[model samples]
Target: MLDYHFQLTRPSLDTIAGILAALFVIYSVSWIIYTRFFHPLARYPGPFWASVSRFWMVSQIRGAHADKTQRELHAHLGSIVRIAPNEVAISDPDAIKTIYGINSGFTKTDFYTPWRPAWCRYPDAFTNLDEPLHASRRRITNSLYSMSSIARAEESIDKCTAVLLEKMASFAEAKRTFDMAGWAQMYAFDVVGQLFFSHMFGCLAAGHDHRGYIRSLDLLLPILCAASVMPTYIRSLFLIGGALVQPRVMKALTSLKDIDEAAEQCIAERHAQLEQGKSGDEKDILASLFAVMREKGEKVDFGRTEVKVEVYVALFAGSDTTAAAVSSVLYHLMKSPAVYKKLTNEIDEATRAGSLSSPIQYKEAAALPYLDACIKEGMRLHPSVGLTLPRHVPAGGCQIAGAWFPEGTRVGVNAAVVHRNRDIFGNDADNFNPDRWFGPDAARMDRYMFQFGGGSRTCIGKNISLCEMYKMIPELLRAYHIELVHPEHEWTTHNYWFNKPSNVETRVTARATGT
Candidate 1:
């Protein structure tokens, strides 16, 4: 009777569920088969399983040290290698110009999409992809970052440098053991704040963690790593179900909100200055932006949104990157005392002649062959923003390394691979050798250095960073002697965005500088 009723009416609940499950299995299988065998991109050579396997690629990226993995793939597969069904990893140095150089039609892929905080009150410069929007925003503030303006801001740079020196001097006076990482990071934060917002983090005075800048950055690191490796679909799911499943995302969003709020306050202060009819040149980055806006017109089109984006970009590019480079350079210096001694002697001589503070300039500093070599070698050996900064090929498609890549293909040049190329750099490529950057070899080395990237998109702050390091390194060496507390200490680098230092502690001691 039950069977008769089931036949006469609708199917049983269990039977319906079984049919649905079977259909789902069939659809998934067919999709995989079609993608692997008949898809438009099937001709591209990659790992057989990875060609149609999103989960495989995600797992590979999620595994430990994905950057090194990409390097190995480049070594084995040559310049152009398929990393995933839609991703190609290019190791050729020329690709840098093609990908990130001026008028490169490629745009940032969805890899950066999840970096947007849910409660973000501003458009972060790092996350903006619309070319026109990016161009407009960059244009409004480009003058502020121009070489002439940066050169004129020398007084501000000197002031900040003095602040850093004073802080280091205090540490020298104490003769106490503390983490160099903390101090270096604090100096970076202070410099960025003073440069951009016309304030300081006061981290050095506190001799502890400052929640002002570092706190927000620390919270965002893991999410940045996770987003890079995990599938976008998965991240979207978390974002969509954020209310229920992703508490950490909510916390990060709140922290970003706090950061934006602080930036808005700074902008408000600038507006007040404008309202007060303050005239002439301004010192910090925001003031410069204001001056440009005023020159353009009294009623420039920027609202709070524009201010937020510019601030976030300044915060991201200025602070954390500076911190990473400084910390890594210091790490290499301390580990190799010979190198440290050479650098210190140069600084000592420069300071004795009063060049450390007086007339300290990026051009002059960049001319210091030893210091330049040390900086480049450090960046090459331990690139802070290691791994691939991915870009998507345009609709017409692209050709790389004598191979045809289809439209919409995700592509990136692995920095580590290019810098460590045995062909270009030799067998000791992995070793830190500053001498390789001296004399005739220096010109050759320039072709492969990928730390600041290349062409028009090369870091606008490279000049600024050079000036800061040129002054700071000399001053710090003159006052203090440092040894790695953990000689075996290693920083964590990933295939994600930034190569971050894992929490590490280093010891410091005072040096007797005969002043």
Candidate 2:
């Protein structure tokens, strides 16, 4: 009886294994056939492996040169290139309006899902995928980030700028070649911190990333970019693996927790001030937000969580972007001595004419055409966000770049690719030339500029960043004689979310007056 039972079970196990192996082979062949020949996007051009798997996109992003890779792909494979099985990168200028314009019906894709903070129950304005919800959020927050609001926050910015100048002076006196990128980030963070929380983050004072916020963000961005292209199940598995294998994952989480705690503390302090009748007529973002909440009453309520999350969004979104822009502008200016001299001459003229004040004012800076051109040209050449701003083709589908894309396709425009189009930006599109922004085709060039993005989903912090750049760049140039530490070699960059400069080391000395 025992011998008969053992024999029967062994044969059954063997038969089951054989059946499973056959099923695996069949599924693999079917998937390959579908992806290669039968998929909706199979007609598009891309690397062979990219057409079959998301791994290619992942590899490009992981390599930190996805922006350059996408540009090369567009150069070789026309405007539309299949980056992933279901994703197409569009670089045609005409496609901008179709994909991102108001009422375009192209919603943000799941690629943004990983951008939502782990602490938030609801997605913040930047990460909200649903169009209606995003619209609602944007509507509520629009007033707070408007140009007028940024104008009101200019004093806070000026305070931080003073600190930055003081820090630079110390560097000048010490005759040290400092990491300008780190200093730019510190300046950005301090300015945002002061504007939002009524406190400086003290990064500049500390002369280092004391809270590890920068490092945390640096680690987190790559992970998010990598996970964005992954299948949901696979992404989950990857995250689990990351937690087990990578200590940086935990550091990132801890950094977020620290940020949340700091925000809560700020909120608590504000409430205490309000209760004690010491909440003066401050005009910072926190004050403006509270004013809105008071006016709305119970009709449009904002809970503690909502307020905290909004503050988190302001800090996270505002800091790195402005820093990258600052770094890009400075790097380009250093690279092109002619452009730098032209820009500094503009600043000096403004100062001499008494139109610009010490630390410079946003309004006066706005009036400098050459300064504006330099800022625009720098942003155009090296946009902070390196990856494509992805959007989903809405139901019923739509035409994009003169072709009809089916519903549910992921379409996006990479700024790096679009900005370098020779037809739109001219033959010198790849070169850094501020003159392009001041030419006869300036208006036409403006139409394709995606530095702050375009359409309804444009960056809410655009005015804030402009305010910083417009003021700070002029101030720095006017006060210091700066030179790149390695003028012979080009600086390196690593693109995760922001195309961050890796080695923006520079030596600074105070400029002799009336030179």
Candidate 3:
């Protein structure tokens, strides 16, 4: 009787499995039908697979071609294209104000949640989506990134710039080829380190990614990109799985953990120094943050974790994007010989006129209209961040690019798409011409340029980045005649979140004075 009962139950288990499988198929079919025809966003033009599921978007992101794909889609589908079931990419310049402008009802989407580390107890300004919370946090930290603050912090930047030039000098002396992108990254990392923690990561001094931090950053981008499009529950599952699965997931986790540990260690050391009666003499960003905390006294709203997150955001967000911008400027300068010559002449004229100093001050560089134009053009052609900055529509819904998007809809502008809009940028939008920025439509172009983002959330670190590039580009060109090793070949880029360049090999020598 026991054997007969067991045999009957085994078939019952199989029956249950069959029922579950049938239900899964039915549910999938229903979801597809609902999203394709019955969904509010179904009327929007998009790829068929994209209209039905987020799988296509995720796959493209994972493949590191999402930016290019979006650009192509926008080119063919006009201003708006449904990249995912709930998300639309807007290429219209006017939509920038509507979606991300000051007091715009659109809040950040859940896409940024994964940006805040799983271990973090609270979100930093970058990861915080709540308007009030972000505003308060931004207010507290705003002065640290203000132009005056950055001007004071120029000493730290100068130090890092010196190290970078020294490294380039060595390459120039040896007549050796080097990866410009790598050196640019080293300079950026060290600059942020010096500015934030009063410590340099030694990437420039050591002549490589000394701490493995850069490599870790490169590895983590694809993971973050994939996580950005996943649903909240699925993303949570990934986090849980990453914690449990030691080997497979640990690789990515370790990279992020290393960065986190570095930040924590820096904070601990700073606290230790404070306990030992060490007064900070340098006007670094950390010093400024500490000052604010002290002013708040017992009512201090933020703590060590908050400080760590801010420093982490500074290092993580600041480094790669700045590096890419610097690299882009150099790449374009090299590609367009006339532009390069014109820029060199301007730098030389400034130097001869006793206007530009050695190591080039930010103010002096700012005055060089041609240099400014070139920087703008470089950023316009190849914006560091290639993905759409996603935002969620408010409860009442709104019109964007002349179409109404319902509440809870995701809408964003991709810099890659917006920067190339022929209507705003002209017919030669694809070309890299610095003169375009000096044209009558220049002001109009600036209005549409989404390189540094827009509105209140505009990158707080924008001044610092511009200061670095403004100083570094002129100084480097004035010192060395740099040439791409393979001028005929295009440098490869991997657009995860930041469009990072690889194999930006170049050979350098001292630039002939007055030539």
List TM-scores for all candidates, in order. Answer: 0.87, 0.96, 0.97
Off by over 4 Å in 3: 119-121, 242-248, 512-515
Residue 411 displacement in candidate 3 (angstroms)? 0.9
Q: What would the per-residue lDDT of candidate 1 be over residues 1-515, giving only the tens digit for each residue?
A: 99899886665777889999999999988977886777756655566666765555556545636567767777676677666667777887778878887688888787776665444543454565665666665566666667777776666666666776666567557755566656767777777777776667677667655565677766656555565555676875654466366787676556666676767777787787678877335578877666565566345566555665566666655766666777778888877889888877776687688665554666666666788888888778767676677888878988776777767888888777788877677778888788787757678778778887665456667766766676666556666677776777665544335665544465556666623
Error of 3 at 61 (Å): 1.7
* lDDT for each residue of candidate 3 in 70-130, tens digit (9 for 90 to 100): 8888888888899889999999899999999999988999899887876666677777899
Assess each prediction's global lDDT (C-alpha) against the native.
0.68, 0.85, 0.86
Q: In model 2, which runs have C-alpha deviations exceeding 4 angstroms?
A: 1-15, 118-122
Residue 506 error, candidate 2, Å: 0.4
lDDT of prediction 1? 0.68
Per-residue C-alpha lDDT of model 2 across residues 144-233, encoded as one tens digit per residue: 888887887788999998898888899899999987888999899888888887788889889888977677678777787888878767
Better of 1 and 2 by lDDT: 2
Ranking by TM-score: 3, 2, 1
What overall lDDT, based on C-alpha atoms, would model 2 receive against the true structure?
A: 0.85
